[model samples]
Target: MKLVVQVKLLPTPVQAAALAMTLRACNAAAEYTSRVAYERNVKSRNELQKLCYREIKERFGLSAQPAVRVVKKVVDAYTALHSGIRAGTLGGERSRRRVKAESKPIAFRASAAQPFDDRCLSWRHDASTVSIWTVAGRLKDIRFAGSADQLATLRAHRRGESDLLFRDGMWFLIATCEVPEPEVFEPTDWIGVDRGIVNLATTSDVDNFQGRRLRRHRRWHARKRAELQAKQTKSANRLLKKRARKEARHATCVNHRIANDIVAVAQRTGRGIALEELRGIRDRVRLHRHQRATQSSWPFHQLERHIAYKARRVGVPVLLVDARYTSQTCPRCKHTARSNRPTRDTFSCRRCGLAGPADVVAAVNIRDRARRAWALVNVPVSMAA
Candidate 1:
């Protein structure tokens, strides 16, 4: 599996200035390449490089490798844009977002991240420093810090390219690491996880990860954002962005904790994890005005991703089952009806008079479904035929 390890860089003022200048130059060169490609309708990396390489080097004071990286970045942006268009993720042909995207050449932010390969960037794991190429010159002995585990992973599995980025006056390098996955063991049972706005997650075993605290946290941030927007000043806008980032970090931390606990339980019990397939959920559900923000901003997908990666690392199988009727169907009586769920948190079966917490019932149904699905998937091929 491929993962990214990010480390914070501590640089002298002079080194920081050089890093900033280098990043700006790289992005400027990228913008120029994008414009040239847009005007000439060039998409191939080699062809675009041929057209912009010499000028990029001369104008941006970039060396051979940086210039090549700039051109490749432009090519990749176009490729991703075209891919999104083909995938209909941007919207339909006549949609305003799609048309707006197609109407202009792609632009790069001045502080956009730039990729550095081994030729331009070298790591000194023993000294906790890195030497990297900059437009001013080559910078050596720039210090970096990370957790012990992260540093270990970087030293052992770091490969391919690293991205240099500046965020909130801090410098970071995100390096890719390829780790080996353990062999999956036969599962003794399944743990079904039901995701919801109120509870966040509820497992078949009745373990609940509540969202009450997080909801309060978001409401506080929302109130602050509203106040900042009312001010409508440049400083207010900047502060708003800072607050948004802080909120995002908090949410990510919560998700990580929840995922770690769930994966740990699954591994300890020799159980696979089952989750609902929630693709395009936003399109399928209708929401009231007050509920839209809560529904849209919830990090349900992030929690799922964390669970998946952690499970994979520990050799726990994950199953994705259909999400429809999970909340409405009765697990005990097998009765399916909307009336079975009389409220958000309660479930009462219409036919057999079964009752339980809605989230737990849904989770139980998910576990049952996974058992049946896994059996069919792993059945011997020639048993009858």
Candidate 2:
């Protein structure tokens, strides 16, 4: 499995200035290359590199590798844009968002991250320092810090390019690491997880990860953001961006904790994990005008991703079961109807009178579905035929 380890860099003032200049120069070169590609209708990385390599080196004062990286960056941006269009993620052909996206060449932010290959960057793990190529010159002995496990992973499995990014007045390098996944063990049972807006997550085992505290936290931030917007000052605008990042970090921390707990239990009980397939959930469900913001802002996908990656690391298998009627179907009587869930949280079967929390019932259904699905998957081919 491929994972990224982020380490914070502590650069001297002189080194920082050089890094800032290098980032700006690279992005400026990328913008120029993008314009040329747009004008010439060229998207091939090699062909575009041939056209812009000299200009990037001479005009932007970049070295050989940095120049090549800039051209590749421009080509990648166009590739991603085209991919989004093809995937219909940007919208339909005639949609305003799609039209706007296609009307202009891609643009890079001034502080956008830049990729550095081995030729342009080298890590000294033992000394906790790095040597990197900058426009000013090669910077040596720039210190970096990370957690013990992160550093170990970097030393053992780090490979490919690292991205240099500046954010929130700090610098970070995100390095890719290819870790070997353990062989998956045969499961004794399964743990089903039901995701929701109010509860965040509920397992078939009746463990609840509530969203009440997070909801309050977001509401407070929203009120503060409204107050800051009303001020209409530069400082307020800056603070708003800072607050948004802070809120995102808090949500991510909460998700990490939940995923860790769930995966730990699954491993301890010799069970696999089952989750509902929720692709395009926003499109499948309708929302009221007042509920749109809350629904859209919740990080349902992130929680699922965390669970999957953590499960993968420990050799626990994960299954995505069908999501339809999980909440409405009665787990005991097998009766299926909207009336089974009279309220958001309560589930009651009219036929057999089975009652419980709606989220737990849904999770139980998911677990049952996984057990049947896994059986069919593992069946021998010549059993009957």
Candidate 3:
């Protein structure tokens, strides 16, 4: 029922400067606020604690919201320490107060404009007000939502709450939104997914969610990464930062396209999507050098999250089947034998003498699980075994 629809934002140069200034203020405020907490917990300081925010405001000249965020973090740390004590998890006889050279906590500011403003990404509310500003029209495109409805909806879902930060160029908020379990569905078909490093994804619904060719963008990615890293001059660094933002934008766009296509496939199939409950395929595949390298490049988690959310939006369900033995178990013979999976990419059942592509075998098993689950779940309407 609740979900987030994030769109890109476009900002002008002036706005970008303002955003940069805001990030600086937040960073400085974080350093100030955290230092205060570190000092206070080292020893009691009732006087200094009272005026911390005022001092930060006067010194850093940050917006009230960003200042408040810093204050919250400082207070949160002490509260955590206190709770740890009562729970007998913290001891007072701690090591010498070796001060950590405090770096500003990652921070970003939001200068949300009015809803109609084309230059801003705005969200306004009775509960919480938020707006997004962008840099020069060329970069840092953000959305600013400024509507009473927007604010009310934002508050309705807590996971969508975010702590804004400016890192790796453009602004970011660690945000989340809930994927509601669907209440209505056709309940006849099921979408099956096969995850891989090269292809990113491949669902059993005719269209491959992602093709299985190992798209080792290593050279391309490394080239960009190197350009980003090899910044010797100030101007060079600035340019690299800008390029990084562009790269991220490009990647996000591609991901969106892929995710949207997946949702479309499910809708066309007239049922829910089913994926193996692979708890940690990475762990299983991480030992080998090639697999490890491939694993690092694959964004499996992001794809699944996108699928879950996209399914929720379309009023479709996403089913996760227990993946244990799904690869080795023969879809035709129902035999659980290691020989059933002769190779990483091939599945064969020794008992029934069945062999096929490993992923297809896995997809069939997952597809069956989904069909059975759907049939059992909607027994009132579906013909169940």
Candidate 1 residue pairs that clash: none
Model 3 ranges off by over 4 Å: 1-15, 42-49, 62-66, 73-186, 210-214, 222-255, 283-286, 353-355, 373-385
lDDT of 1 by residue, 258-375 (tens): 9999999999999999999999888988889999989889788999999999999889999999999999998877889999999999999999999999999999999999999999
Instruction: For model 2, name the residue pairs that clash.
Output: none
Model 1 has an lDDT value of 0.95
Per-model TM-score, in order, reads 0.96, 0.95, 0.64
Best by TM-score: 1
Model 1 residue 215 CA deviation in Å: 0.3
How far is 278's C-alpha from truth in model 3 (Å)? 1.9
Q: lDDT of all the models against the reference? A: 0.95, 0.95, 0.59
Candidate 2 lDDT over 313-342, as tens digits, reads 999999999999999999877999999999
Q: Which ten residues in a row have the lowest lDDT in candidate 3?
A: 111-120
As for TM-score, the candidate ahead, 1 or 3, is 1
Rank the models by lDDT, top first: 1, 2, 3
TM-score of 2: 0.95
How far residue 363's Cα lies from its native spot in candidate 1, in Å, is 1.0
Those runs of model 2 whose alpha carbons end farther than 4 Å from true positions after fitting are 231-237
